[model samples]
Target: MADRGSTELTNPLGALTLDQLRRRTSMKWRRFPPDVLPLWVAEMDVPLAEPVVRALTEAVALGDTGYPSGTRYADALAEFAAGRWGWRIDPDHTAIVPDVMLGVVEMLRLVTGAGDAVVVNPPVYPPFYQFIVHSGRRVVEAPLGEDGRLDPATLAPAFRDATTGGRPAAYLLCSPHNPTGTVHTRDELSAVAELAGRYGVRVIADEIHAPLVLPGAEFVPYLTVPGGENGLALLSASKAWNLAGLKAALAVAGPAAAADLARLPEEVSHGPSHLGIIAHSAALTEGGGWLTGLLSGLDANRLLLAELLAERLPAVRYRPPEGTYLAWLDCRRLGLGDDPAATFLEWGRVALNPGPEFGTGGAGHVRLNLATSPENVAEAVHRMVAALD
Candidate 1:
């Protein structure tokens, strides 16, 4: 394990080599063959923070695996939010859920009915479509602008269309958005709240990537903005701490939305893993130093990726993401067809997420994971450049 101190000099991403990474059986490494370089998923290529490891180890050593109970996770998250973002969270208003996406499904159920519309900004996370549909709701796209920021013009129409016939509607907002990694600003979130209010559309924010906001960018919590009292947000330590296998998240309701959140079924609380709660609570409470170190590493990796792309693959357009560790690359100029990821994998042996899967405006693009060593980022780009030869 690397240094667990809060020093920005600690390089968590550089702590492990490719050989060590491949030995593990996580989805990011095992999804592709040995010859391929996998950068397709959101999983980070780092070891667990010492605090998280110690907490889980102690629990297991004592055979403490059992059902989850109490407000530990919520209280921890409240502390994290208050200290990190200066956003106060009333733990009493938060409910523990299985994970962010499942929490989203439950939040949608509170505000929307069967077959009602749920608006999303596309070229967004692919699962936003899948889970919404699976939850028995219709998807309405308000694709992000060409610059990858939310556009009120687009959102207005989508919100209006979704609420057609006065049907209940919900908007799934991805804060510190995935794939693009564009952090939503306070003004932008306020705009969304205004428009959603006008259209009578409920806002359900998926803020899983909130903790990953890199330097030079600020993350604005949706529920903190004006007119957002009716909104709900899902938060978790899974993304920042890489604890996806340990499933747990919080569904937090705004002041005005507290009653709606109360309607969520009591059985939903049973889904989270008790051990997962322990790990996540420890992460939120005692892992701040480790998180600072990880953020420092990710901050450097994002820039390193930009430098590599600019030097070797200049034709590939990339905008250094303001948040998250995902890079959205435009490969249209590289002549790789609509699904450039397939070509990259077949020829470059570099696995990237096919952009078309992210819905409208995603063609001729690819999403690369940046949560890895700087060496891996350079090598991935090198393989991509070689594919064109």
Candidate 2:
């Protein structure tokens, strides 16, 4: 059977023209100068799915803009999880929040007190550092293995240090980890659960990118592990469906952690937009076909990126990300010092996320957004090659 593609199966997730994308006021396009090809942010440069557009349009037609309420988002998410990931979700155990990071912070607050240690893996997400700090908690780094994947050897020490001071602690996990796009496996997650349970460190999972797992790769929900019955997971349709501007996410507690989630202040739910809930719920329910198509497109782009890097920027080392639209490029071979993203931005006029900002082993690297068109991807590469010249 000749496999066609997700775009061919459902809707075509278009890669809009430069002029088409620049007119928008979103952060990805708006943050950069007119001459720069902006590819730093996680925002996709594609149009919304038919279901999402319809949901938002219907909301506006009915003048239904108000504060968010009810479990429709949770219900939709439960339905989606069962169909996609084979995980049974209890809608009653889920609650709505403004976004994933905020939900993580609230979850941290639920499990820990001020000055408690929050162990994290880096070259991970940049915000994992900021949000933990903002929560008045201490940040402990457990750098990933040399392969850019979680290692028990590194984690065990971090867990011990975090709990040694007899301070309360939590493990902030980035499943389908950001920047590197390393999707933690079932066995890996089970090992993590065992370690966390052994050390009595609460696990807080940020699974915002759960739905974007590339082809041939599987995304394992941390809470589904053996010892995760007391863990908390933050999920949303924002990343997969490119609905970040909509502002709504869910906090899902494992069987035993529902009480901890319930302790979250009611005021926390007040921040999510009503339209955001409608759109996210619609994405989970009616946007599957579109997501299928988008994934096919991303799978193509991920491979295309590897080929492009190999052809033009041979000095730059890149691994086709296991998940997410972001590409972490190691530019150490270029002798570009600590921050190659800055050099690329200034010389190539192509803005990428500086690696050092991602902490620990992040230097000598740059994160490239790959959720754009193939042509644009090629153009970005051309610019990078020119920068090196």
> How does each model score on lDDT?
0.91, 0.90
What TM-score does model 1 achieve against the real structure?
0.97
* Residue 273 lDDT in candidate 2: 90
Scored against the true structure, residue 118 in model 2 reaches a CA lDDT of 95
Going through the candidates in the order shown, the clash numbers are 0, 1
Identify the leading candidate in terms of TM-score.
1
lDDT of 1 by residue, 86-155 (tens): 8999998999999999999999988888999999999999999999999999999999998999999899
In candidate 1, stretches whose alpha carbon ends up further than 4 angstroms from where it belongs are: 1-9
Write candidate 2's Cα lDDT for 149-180 as tens digits: 99999999999999986777999999999999
Instruction: Name the best candidate (by lDDT).
Output: 1
